[model samples]
Target: MNLLRTLAAISSMTMVSRITGLLRDTLFARAFGASPYTDAFYIAFRLPNLLRRLFGEGAFSQAFVPILAEYKNQKGEEATRSLVDHVATTLVWATVVVSVLGIVAAPLILMGIASGLDGDGFDKGVVMTRLMFPYIACMSFVVLAGAVLNTWREFKIPAFTPVLWNLSSIFFSLFLVQYFEVPIYSMAVAVMVGGVAQVAIQIPALKRIGMLPRLSFNPLSGLKDPGVRRILKKMGPAVFAVSAAQISLLINTNYASNMGGGAVSVLQYADRLMEFPTGILGVALGTILLPSLSKANADGDIGEYSALLDWGLRLTFLLALPAAVGLAALSTPLIAALFNYGEFNAANVAAATAPLMSYAAGLLGIILVKILAPAFYARQDIRTPVRIAIGVLIATQAMNLVFVQMLGMGVAGLALSIGLGACLNALFLYTGLRRRSIYTPHAGWLGFFLKVVVAVVLMGLAAWFSQAQLDWAGLRSHPVLRIVALLAIIALSAIVYFAVLFALGFRPRDFMRRAK
Candidate 1:
């Protein structure tokens, strides 16, 4: 398989989903505004989403894929299919139990997670949480299905499946909100609808690939396989390791809940902006590289493993640097164009810009974790990453205490701490890889790093200069003008960024194919 081609396909589809997500956020900002209702909805949606990352995307897939790949490679089709059927059967039962319990425990969970919220915010969040809890069950099946397809190299449909989540949320936020007296309930229902839609869309893909598990009530079927035990063992540590980002989010949410009034929403908007490039670069690379790296590890080919990691790292650096720089520089305009309408005003945009820049400052670090953590995971070394995650979490809380509570930095403080922590997480992983000799540079990394830095510098200069050309008045005064200006700035920065890299002896073709 062409690794670059695979990355491109996944990233492109993910990009579409992220775009729709942005539109959904825009509508959310316009409809819900920065109120207790908005905060409640975010809190409601986030709890299940956190576990989604933990169980679905973060832990389950990481453990399942490496083992699944090993099974397919070492065993025959019968063995591989049997493992899938049993695991699928087991996961379905577990998901149902978790969803029912989560729904029943909604109010208690709300109090536990978002304790600062009180009265209406607290009550409303409990209602919304129950409405959205079943989504966890739906998406659990969705991601398990997705992991199966992804392991089989059926990347597109699974990657594009997230479009359902965004589309349903947007439809509800835009159209259905008006019908509901309390708009957030509609949004919660949309979450459930979208989850079902996402799972439904991917069902046929599994059949097409002949990998779909025939769901059965044989709860103990998975216990018959040693691979299931191996996956569960890995999952224990992998959950915390892969969920470092979401942990940071929960921490931030706890603090932001105390801050009162729109702080959470502002931070979220900034995160949404940061996620655009991340979806394209970090997510794209990480998802594609894991299976490849696992195969390489299974073959005991250290050279191929290192080479795949190297390729992913360089590509991440190439993309993440300019994105980080561009986002930090252009935060104001981007926020203004997409979100500075309806209830989102100048003050909201200004508030969001700080966190946006703060988050952008750590974009490379945040994305690097995505890039590097998989190397540990593919090799089934989950404990090292878990240790790193623990250290980073402590560092994050200390910084949060200083930045948010002591220094009074407010929402931006949470953003800054997250960025700094991400840097530490990536650094720890890099050093660990070196010490273990799990990954070594293929050659030309310093040159590649320097070249990307130079390009990003030029790009940043161009972005800074271009922003000077547009005042706050012209950028935000009219919707059409704001859209045009933001696009122009983005295009100009991208051109300069790529042009500089191209002129400095960097070729796009080189990145598309790994160094031989």
Candidate 2:
């Protein structure tokens, strides 16, 4: 398979998901704005959302996919099918128990995560947490299904499934707000409905591959399977690695909650804008790389393994640098164009811009971590990342203390700390790879870096000038004009970036590679 084509396909699907997600966030901003109540909903949603990443996508996928690929590579189809059945059964049992515990302990969970909430805000958070807790089970199933599909090289379904969730939320936020006394509760309900939709679509896709997992009647049935045992053992470290990041986020949320009423919401809004590039590049590349890396490792082809890592890193720098430049240069206009409707006002746009700019600073590093982490995971070595993650977690908090407390940067400081931590995490992971001689940088990197830096500088200047021509705040009354102007600026900036790359002797064929 052509890796570039596969990455493009997955990225196209993910682009659709991100667009719909932006629409959903825009609706929320317009409907509820940034307030203590919206803060309650965002914070409450963060728990199940956190679990969705922690268990479903992050650790579980990291542990599960490489092993699944190994089984496919070494074992026969029947053995692979059996492994799937057992793993699915185990995941179902574990998620069910976790969901129950989360529902029952919702109040305590909210208290621990966002202790600054008080009275009705805290009460609403608890209730919303309980209502959305079971969404984890649904997403766990969805991710398990996705892992199977991805291992089979069926990337479209997994990449596109997120759009269902986004659409579900958009529909609810648009039409169902009036049904509830507290409209924000509708978002919680939407989360559950979206989860179900995501899981439902995975069924036919799994059936097409004839890898549909026949779950066992008894939850303990998969415990004796050696493959399941190995995956579980690997998961021990994977969970810790993922949790380290999540814990930092939780701490940030707690800090934001204590800062003021709309602090969490402001951060959430900035995060939503950041997700556009991250989902398209970071997630898309990571999803495509891991299984291929696993195959190369399984075949014991050191050259192929190193080549794959080099290709991913080069693509990351080529694309991510431009995206980060665009985000930083056009932060205010981007925020104003997408939001600044209904309940989202000039103040909200202004509040979100700094954090967005801060996030943009580390955008390339964040995407690099997505590329770099999978190198370790594909080798079935989760321990190194866990160790690095633990250190980064501690360092992130230290930076948080300095940026948020000592410097008094508020929410923007919280974002900056996370950004810097990601850069540090990526650096450590790269050094580990090099120290072990696992990945040797291919020739021409210096020239490539210089070209990209030059291109990004040109693109950033064009974007800055175009964005400055418009008063984004004043254009709030003309939403169409504002959105059109923003899109035009983005398009022009992208043109300039690619044109410069072309003039610098870069070509699409130069980066293309096939993975077997």
Candidate 3:
């Protein structure tokens, strides 16, 4: 597959999801404000999200995709289909049990993570927790279906399915807020609805691809499948590897819960802002790279594997660097434009901007982790990344403690600490890859790095100048102008970044255009 082409499809679709997500969050902020109620909902929502990341996106996708690819390549269609059936059967049973147990234990889980929530906040969280529990179970099938589609190189539908998620959430959160006594409860309904839609939207695509598994209830059926066994074996360490960042977020949220009103919401808003470019570039690239890398490794073509890694890294830095710079420079305006409305006012915007900038600082680092960790997983070297991730997690939490507890830096501190820790994690992963000679710097890297950095500097200067010129505070009440101004600035900076790079001879065709 054409990496850039596939990436563009995923990125564009993710961009839609991100845009709709902004609308959802904007509505959320207006409806709930930066209060304990919002915090309670976020914590409640996070319980299933934490598991979704662990089992669905993070560990399961990482562990599942490569194995699926291998089965498709090594075994015939019938065998791979059987393997899929077995895996699907296993996940269906497992997700059901976990969701049931989680629903029953909602209060205990809420208490364990959210000790700082008062009685009402705790009760709200418990309720939403139970409501959102089914989402994880639904998404487990969604993840498995997505992996099968991806293995068949059916990337577009899987990518587009998130649009359903965002749209479902956006519609319910915006329209249904009035009906609920606690408005955020409507959002919990949206979460489950979106989960169902996410799975539903992919079914036709899976059918078209002819890779959809027939549902089987025999859990022990997969127990004897070697592919399933390998997946289960890898999933243990992969969980730790993938769960590390989620673990950090869980810790940060726990810490923020004690920091008084709106603290967690501030962090979530900043994170949402950061995720825009991240989902587009880092996630898009990793999603494109992994299957190809796995195929290369399975074919025992180390050169192709190395080359693909090199391409992914170069593409990552080129995009991630300027994205980080532009985002950090325009952090305040962007936050103001997207979220400063109704109950989410200037104070909330100000509260979120610092952390957004902090998050932007680690943009490249976070993307690097996305790209580099898959390098290990595609090769079935899961333990190394897990160790690296655990160390990074500890360091991040340590920094969080010092910044939030010792220095009392609050949200920005936590954000900065995580950003810095991401850099460290990326560095260690890159260094490990190089030391092992798994990935060597391709020729012209120095020139590529210099040119990209120079372009980023130019983009950064333009963004800073534009931010200084805009009167965001005055424009806040004029929502239309405020949004227009923010978009104008974003357009100008993006133009500058790309135009400068193009002027300096950077071409998309270089890394992406495959040898025909």
Candidate 4:
């Protein structure tokens, strides 16, 4: 496979997903703004989202995919299909139990995460949490199908299916708000609908691949499958790895909740902005690399395995650095143009900008984590990342103490802590890979770094100049002009970045590689 072309395909589909997600956030900000109610809803949404990451795409995918790949590569078609069916049955049963428990324990969970929430906010959070709890089940199934599809090298469907969820949320944010007694409940409704839509869209694709899982009616039916046992054993550490990261987020949300009414909402706004590049670049590369990496490992081809990691790292820096620079340099305009409307005003935009810049500061590190960690996961070495994650969790909380409590940087401190921790995590993962001699840097890295640095510096300057040309929040009455100006600034900055790279002897083909 041409990895560059495959990466582009997945990234393009992911870009569409991110674009719609931004639109959904934009609409949400306009309709709701930053409020206790919005905070309530965000807090409510975080649990199911945490589960989606933990059980769906995070731990489960890390553990399941490589094993599924092994089944396909070593055990042949019938065995691989059997593995899928058993895994599907096991995952469904597990998801159902977690969903029921989450629903029943909604209030306790809310209190555990956001103890500082007001009585009314707490009540609303509980209701929304209950409403969205089952979303985990839908998303679990979605991720299960997505993993199967990605392992089959059918990347388009998995990448495109997320757009369905974003559209569902956008629809609810647009048309359903007025019907709810508490308008934020509409978002909870959107989550469930979107989850189902995501799952529904992948069914035919799975069938076409002949990997459609025939789920057992009885939960115990798949418990004894050898492949399922292997997955479960791997998931033990994988769960801890994902859980450690979620615990840090839970701690941050708790801190944000106590900070004030709008704290969680603003951090969420900044996070949505950060997700744009991470999804397009980090997620796109990670999604494609894992299956390929696992294939190399399964074939016992050490050279191909190391080369794949090198390719992903080089591509990550090539793309992620400029994105980070653009975000930091144009934080105000980006936040203002996209979110400063109706309920979300100048102050909210300003509030969100600090965290966005902090997030941008570590954007490369954040994305690097995506690239480097998969080196271990593809080898089915989940323990290494889990240990690193646990240690990073501890270090992050320590930084939070100094940055948030001691320094009183508030939401920005929380974000900065996470960013720096990600850098620390990525650094450790890199050192581990080097120590194990799993990855060796290819020649021309020095030249590549220099070219990227010069190009990124130029792009950053362009972004700075563009942001200075607009009173982003002041032009709220001229929404069309504000949006057009933002788009032009982004376009011109991108042109300057890529143009500089081309002049510096960087070409698309220089970075392209074949997986086989």
The digit string of per-residue lDDT tens for model 4 on 1-516 reads 899999999999999999999999999999999999999999999988998898878889999989999999999999999989999999998989999999999989998999889789999999999999998899888899989999889999999998988899899888888898888888999988998888889889998999888999999989889889989988888876655646677789999999888899999999989989999999999999999999999999999999999899999998999999998998998899889998998899999999999999888888898888888989999889999998999999999999999998999999998888889989999999999999999898898899899999989998898789778889999989988988998899899999998887777888789988
> What's the best-to-worst order under TM-score?
2, 4, 3, 1
Write model 1 residue lDDT over 1-516, tens digit each, in one string: 888888888998999999999999999888777777788888888889998889898999888988998998899788888888888887788878888999999999998888788899889999999898888888888888988888888889988999998999998887788898777899899988999999899889988988888777777778777878888899988888888878989979988888887777888889889989988888878888888888889999999899888888888888899999999989888888888778887888888999999999899998999889989989989899999998898899999999988999999999999999999999999999999999998888888898888889989999988886776534555789778878898999999988888888887678765422
Ranking by lDDT: 2, 4, 1, 3
3 or 4, which is superior by TM-score?
4
lDDT of 2 by residue, 1-516 (tens): 999999999999999999999999999899988999999998998988888888888899999999999999999799999999999999988998999999999999999999899889999999999999999899999999999999989999999999998999999988888999988899999999999999899999999999988999899999889999999998878876755656787789999999888899989888888878988999999998999999999999999999999999999999998998898899999888887899899998999999999899878878888889999999999999999999999999999999999999999999888888888889999999999999999999999999999999999999999999889999988999989899999999999999999999999999999997
TM-score each candidate: 0.97, 0.99, 0.98, 0.99
Lowest lDDT block of 10, candidate 3: 507-516
**Residue 140 lDDT in candidate 2:** 90
Model 4's TM-score against the true structure:
0.99
Worst 10 residues of 4 by lDDT: 239-248
Q: In model 3, how large is the Cα lDDT of residue 290?
A: 84
Candidate 2 clashing pairs? none
Q: What is the lDDT of residue 389 in candidate 1?
A: 92
Error of 1 at 33 (Å): 1.4
- In model 2, state the lDDT of residue 465: 97
lDDT agreement with native, every candidate: 0.87, 0.91, 0.86, 0.90
Candidate 3: segments with Cα more than 4 A from true spot? none
